[model samples]
Target: LEKKIAHQDAIERNAIEGKFGEGKRKYGLGRISARLQTTSETVIALQFLVMNLEKVLRDTFLSFFQIWKALYLFVNRKKYTLIIEK
Candidate 1:
């Protein structure tokens, strides 16, 4: 399970980097095609941009918040009230 998780993380990172690094290389062709009005596609370069950013964002919410919730539940599962006197 640990190995599988690590491998998935590496693949996700590589995909993110590749998509960001050579995005314009791929999109330049699309831009040229759009200029020529080759088709009605609008070259969703912005969509790809948001998708990559969203991966990191979604990972963060899953990892941090999920763990935090579990920990909070474990820690405060049995809450007790105490009177403070000073």
Candidate 2:
């Protein structure tokens, strides 16, 4: 059980590290410009917020595409059946 928990923790840590790495590379978060500690913290928070919003948007689009594909296939199947009947 302890080993399993340790593995899970490592996976979580890796995911967080990956997110930070991505933010640093993509959003210029590697070097914060603010001198004040609070300002720097806020900057980091905003960067993560942007990242989360982007992720949510991408996921939403993917889900919408999947639903659209399913609906298209269903409609096409019905059309094909009608053609066969005629």
Candidate 3:
């Protein structure tokens, strides 16, 4: 049980660290130019917010594209069947 708990904690730590690494890579979180403590904190917070929002937006767009693709395929298949019957 103790080992299981430790493993879960490590997994959680890795996930959190991965998000920070992503923000640094994609949103410039590592290069905050703010000179004040509060400003820097705010900058980091905004970067995380932007990262999360972008993920949500990207997922939404991908889902929309998938739906559109399915619709297109369905319509095209119907058209081909009609052509073959005629």
Candidate 4:
């Protein structure tokens, strides 16, 4: 049971750490140069916000693409059958 719990914790930690790593690598989280505390906080907050928004946009686009692809295949399947019958 302890090992299971440790494994689960590691999984969660890796996910959180991966997000930070992604932010640092892709979103300039590591390059903030603000000297003021408030400015630094604001920059970090904005970077996180942008990351979350990007995730949402990507998920939404993928969902839409999947739905569109399904509809297209369904329509084409019927057309294909009709053409074969003729």
Measured by lDDT, the strongest candidate is 4
lDDT of each: 0.69, 0.92, 0.91, 0.95
Q: Is candidate 3 or candidate 4 better by TM-score?
A: 3
Off by over 4 Å in 2: 1-9, 78-86
| TM-score head-to-head 1 vs 3, winner | 3
Alpha-carbon RMSD to native, per candidate: 11.5, 3.4, 2.9, 2.8
The candidate 3 region of ten consecutive residues with least summed lDDT is 77-86
1 or 3: which has the higher lDDT? 3
Instruction: Tell me the TM-score of each prediction against the true structure.
Output: 0.36, 0.75, 0.82, 0.76
lDDT of 1 by residue, 1-86 (tens): 99999999999999877775665575452343454333423455454666668789999989999999889988987674456899
Candidates by TM-score, descending order? 3, 4, 2, 1
Q: How close is candidate 4 to the true structure, as a TM-score?
A: 0.76
Top of the candidates by TM-score: 3
Residues forming the 10-long window of minimal summed lDDT in candidate 4:
77-86
lDDT of 3 by residue, 20-83 (tens): 8988898998889999999999999888888889989999999999999989988888665644
Please, what are the lDDT tens digits per residue for candidate 2 over residues 1-86? 99999999999999999988999999989889899999999999999899889999999999999999989988888665654453
Candidate 4's error at 42, in angstroms?
0.6
